[model samples]
Target: MRSLLVAVCLVLALHCGEAAVSCNTVAEDLYPCVSYVAQGGYVPATCCTGIRALNTQAQTAVDRQSVCRCIKSAIGGLSLTPNNINNALSLPAKCGVNLPYRISPSTNCDSIN
Candidate 1:
């Protein structure tokens, strides 16, 4: 009984951890792209790396929606210009992620899935 309980707890913990996506993690991964996206400059290597990581990490529909929400919130908090928004929207294609939904302030995250 004790071993069964321990095994169940371990499985639950792992499942919960895998299902969680933190906003801070998304922000940190996307931070490197700010300058390039906001200034219309070349996409940096670090930004590509972060984009790929995010693409890989957000495999599920739920994860993708979470990422969209986090990105939308982050962009809202920033003072990015129109050019910046355009560049940022283009990052997924630039990085070859082929995201299903567009990344914009008005993107309905509920429709991402």
Candidate 2:
């Protein structure tokens, strides 16, 4: 719950060029879809598709608290840091999205942007 909120808040804030996008939405939205994958269950393509939609809106993200919250809710027990931030941002991009990274938190994602 906290993770989801954090991720959303970050993405929402970044839309104005302050935040950076995290792939929490991709993980959150996809993790529950094929619970029985090991049992031979199949995940719908749309799950990733939806993640892509969300990513489109977050290209200029801010890396806010909400994104961290969303990541917490999505990853369960993982930690947050600048290292994995790129990976988290890359998830939805695999599905076909811009998903750019910003240079600084003080800046609106990109220094020039």
Candidate 3:
């Protein structure tokens, strides 16, 4: 019985690890862009790199919604000004990513699909 329990636990761990990336992962990926988005200036190449990676990673509807929620939450925590929000919204175009939905704190993630 102990061996069976151990096997079950191992399987569950593996399954959880294989699950889709979390909102925190998305937030981490976008963390580097905060400065650029917060200030009015040329966005660094590294910022674009992270944005593109986020676009590619969030391909599915669920993933997109997760990303949206993460972006909203992450930006809210940043204490950026209104201009920062505008600059952040322009990232997709600047980075050449065609995001399916707007990146805003008020966005409804459930309506992404």
Provide TM-scores for the models: 0.77, 0.34, 0.75
- Candidate 3 per-residue lDDT, tens place, 1-113, comes to 24423332343233321216565466556656756665658887877887888778877888887777666655544455688778888888998988888867667877986
Considering summed lDDT, which 10 consecutive residues are worst modelled in model 3? Answer: 10-19
lDDT of 2: 0.41
Give candidate 2 regions above 4 Å deviation.
Answer: 1-43, 63-69, 78-94, 97-113
lDDT per residue as tens, model 1, 1-113: 24423332343233322235656666667767767775666888888888888778888888888877777765655555688679989998888778767777878987977
Best by TM-score: 1
Better of 1 and 3 by TM-score: 1
- Residue pairs with colliding backbones in model 3 are none
- Tell me the tens digit of each residue's lDDT in model 2 across 10-109: 5433333224544544345544322222122343566456555555544333443334334444433334355344444444444554534321232232
